[model samples]
Target: MGCCSDFLQRAKPYVAMISLQFGYAGMNIISKVSLNHGMSHYVLVVYRHAFATLSIAPFALYFERNVWPRITFSIFVQIFVLGLLGPVIDQNFYYAGLKFTSPTFSCAMSNILPAMTFVMAVICRMEKVDLKKIRCQAKVVGTLVTVAGAMLMTLYKGPIMEMVWTKHVQPHRSSVPETTDSSDKDWLKGSIFLVIATLAWAALFVLQAVTLKQYSAQLSLTTLICFMGTLQAIAVTLVMEHKPSVWKIGWDMNLLAAAYAGIVTSSIAYYVQGLVMQSRGPVFASAFSPLMMIIVAIMDSFILAEKIYLGGVLGAVLIVVGLYSVLWGKYKENKDIKESKVMALPLAITCSEGNGHNMDLENEDRRERKPMA
Candidate 1:
């Protein structure tokens, strides 16, 4: 029972992270369906978070009813900022990019998060630098490689690879048009949006790490983020979405997409992510993001009939390489720190014990040498 419990404790986070990716992959499929059916992304964001707020509110109120901390202006400001960074700015830009690109393309591009987060952490002085260490050098090289991969994906679109799913595919209206002018234009535009979104996501990872220190209730914190995200998205929706018709969600696929996005992606996902971050730290939680690329690629191949491009495949390979390189470097550095502490412990104990024994001897010698005692 003890061993089984230990195994479960270790396996829980990995399960949660993988499950999160599955939710994201489903969201991508449903979202593409809704977008193709003429639902505006802006309005979708508004509704997604609104339902997310509703779904999470009851749990937050119930679980944290008595244990809630005193809310301060600073904490409220932090949560508001988190809402803007994540669900508002990050998600809006992401959807805009996805509108102009395929799910696999967007997910592959987001593989830059690990490198992006490292650079941002250094800039913010949250992470220490040691250029002499090979670990630090690996991280720097990994960041450059990841960025290069992103650029390669944006600038190049080589021959399409034939896959088995191509035979069973049905054409979708939302797929990018096959033309030099339109494809190139939309690719660049969407890539820009995705890059900005990735940066916002990386910043959020760092900010959440800091904020969790101040506001320790993970569920309540995520609930506040969703609530504020709903309001912010609505504000954006009001400015950009002028058509009341676009906001009309009926008993069709739009409602299904919204329900999936709200209940599964936003509410459940946000809560699970909060729990994981509370346990594993930000990088550990965010490192699982690359898994979405594979999930999306496979799902889109079948569901969206998206063609696989040579450049995208190669870029994704490079990005995955760089992602894992940085993670390995971090792991090695942390391990070294632990091993160093372990090695020093015995030496420290030995030095103190020897000093104590010497003092005892010296005191006894002085007493023996005393003229009278």
Candidate 2:
């Protein structure tokens, strides 16, 4: 009974993370369907954040009312920028890209996020790199490999690989013309948009790390970011989409997409990921991202009858490999740091217990002693 309970405790984080990935996959597919049905990306962004803000606000108000810190000018500016990068820029561009391309492609391309974040961190001097260290070398190599995979996916759209279900399901053609030249151009454009969105997402993560120092109430911070993002997205939506009709959503996929993305992906995902990260660490949480890509690929083929290409398959493989390499390096680096700290404590205690002369003589004697055969 004890062993079974212990096993279940260990399995909880894995189960939660896997379920979270499935939720993300559902968001991508549903959002793609909504975009296909003439829902403007601009309007979608606004509504999504509005729902997110409403969902998160009550919890923030109730739980963080006592502990919430005073918002200063600098913190406000950071929060504003966070809102801009996340809701306004990231979601809009991501939705736009998904409109042009398939959900699987977008999800696969998003796996480059860690590589982009690493580069940005290096540029910001927030991360250190030592060529001599194998861990650093792995990270550098993995980033390069990830970039190569993205380039491959963008430049080469090899022959479409047919799936069993796709053979039976009629291809759901969109309003957009599928001429070879136009489709290729649209794919390139979508790839560029997805890349831009990923970069903004990475920047948001970096900025969020810095912002947390001043404002430590995470729920309140998330609520404020969502509220500010909602306002910003509304302004952008008004500017981009003049048609009031675009704002109208009923009991359909649009409403479902908005509600699911805002509530499940934005609010609940953040909370659940935080819980999992607390138990298994951030590496474990992020390690399952590629699983979402795979799930989306399968679901896209089955549901949307979307065509998959050989180049995309190959590229996704490379990205997954590179992602694991980077994660492994990070895990090793963290383990080494923890081990060093543990070793330092005992050494510090030993030095503190002995007089300086005695400690020095003991150290010399230990160094002078020969190993037994």
Candidate 3:
């Protein structure tokens, strides 16, 4: 029964992980479609945060009203930083990158997030190093390998034929002349931007882990940060775009997509992630995100009609393998620690009994040796 209960507990997180993966993949498709339909990424971010703020505000008020009075300046500062790193910087960089790179590449590049987070955590002293521990060594090496995979995926664009399996494909018969002379340059720029976005996301995970220790109310904290971030995003859009027309909201599929991203993806998915993080720790929660890349790759191929290259496949595999290697190392280290503790319990009890028995024998000997008492 205990084992069954433990299994169920573990299964809950895996289920949440699957949901997050699917949610993120759907977010990729919807965001791409929305972008193609002429929605500016900046304005779309504004709408997402605006709607997410509104959606979560009521719940935060209702559930956390009594605790609202406890919020302090320090907490507010933490939330401010959280908002900047998470919703503002991370979202802006991501959308900007998406504008330049294909969804598949964006998703594949995102798999580096865990590695990035590990590096950032190490830098921040949130994680400790033990060079003697193979588990720790594996984590460090796996993180490096994952970063290398990301770099390869970003910089190396091999022949298209390597990606496509079709034999004897007809050459392009287009009589129309190409217009752009700097298309490759633009693509490269976009890929670079997306890599920056992944780095920002990785940093956000590290910050969240630190902040969660101080602010235990994940929902309330998230709501406040998101609310503030909406205002920041709006200000940014206004300053950058500077046109009144950019703020115009249209009632179309694009609007629906924005709403889905806001309400479902931003609000719901974030809350679920926070809950999972609280239960399973940051690495366990984030290790599942790479699965989103697989889902995105499949969706892009069938739905968006994007091509899957061999390099992309290899990069994706490298990322996934590296991610699991880190997680496995952590898991084994934790298991060994627990086992060591369990084994030490018997030794501890034996030592205590031996000391007590020696004391008792000494007392008896002293009592028996006492002169005619």
Candidate 4:
């Protein structure tokens, strides 16, 4: 029983990461459907974050009321940027990309995030890279390989596979399958949007890491982020969407998208990720992202009856390989660093003892030499 408890404790992080990825995959699919059903991405952003703020703010206030840190001007600015990058830019562009492309494609592009975050961290000096170390070398090479995979997937789309379901029932599809010219144009455009989205996501990860160091209340921080995101989305919606009717939703997929994205993906995910980042670093939390890509691929293909291409298969494999390579390198580097630190303590103690002994012998020799005095 004790061993089982210990095992569960050890496996908790892995389980949480997998669960979070699955949640994100669901969000992508639901959002894609809602968009296809005539839901506007801009409006979706406003509703999603607004609901997120409402859902999480109470808990944050209740749990962190006593311990919440003061919100200084710098921290407020950082939080505002966080909101802009995450809820506004990243989500809006990503939703637009999904409207133009498939869920699988966008999710696959998201796999490039670990590499992006690694580069950004190194640039920010949050992560140190020792060029001579094999681990660091692998990380760099793996990042390049991941980027190459994403590019190949975006630029080259081979013939679509003749899946069994592609010819059968098309449930909840807004339009017939895309034409060659139209699909190509949209794919290119969506790929561009997704690339920017991924960059923003990476930047958010780095920023969140930095912000957490200053304000350690994870739940409260997430609530603040959600609040800021809601306000930003509101500002954007007011500027772009003029019609009041556009915001109306009675009982449709738009409501589904808003509820699911708000409650599960944004509010819960933000808080959970904050907790995870507190325990593990940002990269560790981001490493689980590839799982969502794979999940989205399956869900899109089988459920959505979306066409899968040969290039996609090859690219997904390469991205997965790169993701693992980076993870392995990071794991090895962390292990080595911990071991080195542990070994350093005993060596330090031994050196201290040796120096103390040498000092005692030198004092005795001096006393003997001055015996006549």
lDDT of each: 0.80, 0.80, 0.75, 0.84
| Candidate 2 overall lDDT versus native | 0.80
lDDT of 4 by residue, 183-276 (tens): 7788788878998999999999889999999999888888889889989998898898899888898788899899899989999988777777
What TM-score does each of the candidates earn?
0.84, 0.83, 0.83, 0.86
Q: Give lDDT tens digits, candidate 1, residues 326-363.
A: 66676677678879999999999999999999999999
lDDT minimum window of 10 residues, candidate 3:
170-179
| Strongest candidate by TM-score | 4
* RMSD, every candidate, angstroms: 3.3, 6.9, 4.2, 3.4
Ranking by lDDT: 4, 1, 2, 3
Least accurate stretch of 10 residues (summed lDDT) in model 2?
A: 277-286
Kindly report which residue pairs in candidate 4 clash with one another: none
Candidates sorted on TM-score, descending: 4, 1, 3, 2
**After superposition, which runs of candidate 3 have C-alpha atoms over 4 Å from their true positions?**
66-69, 151-180, 340-373
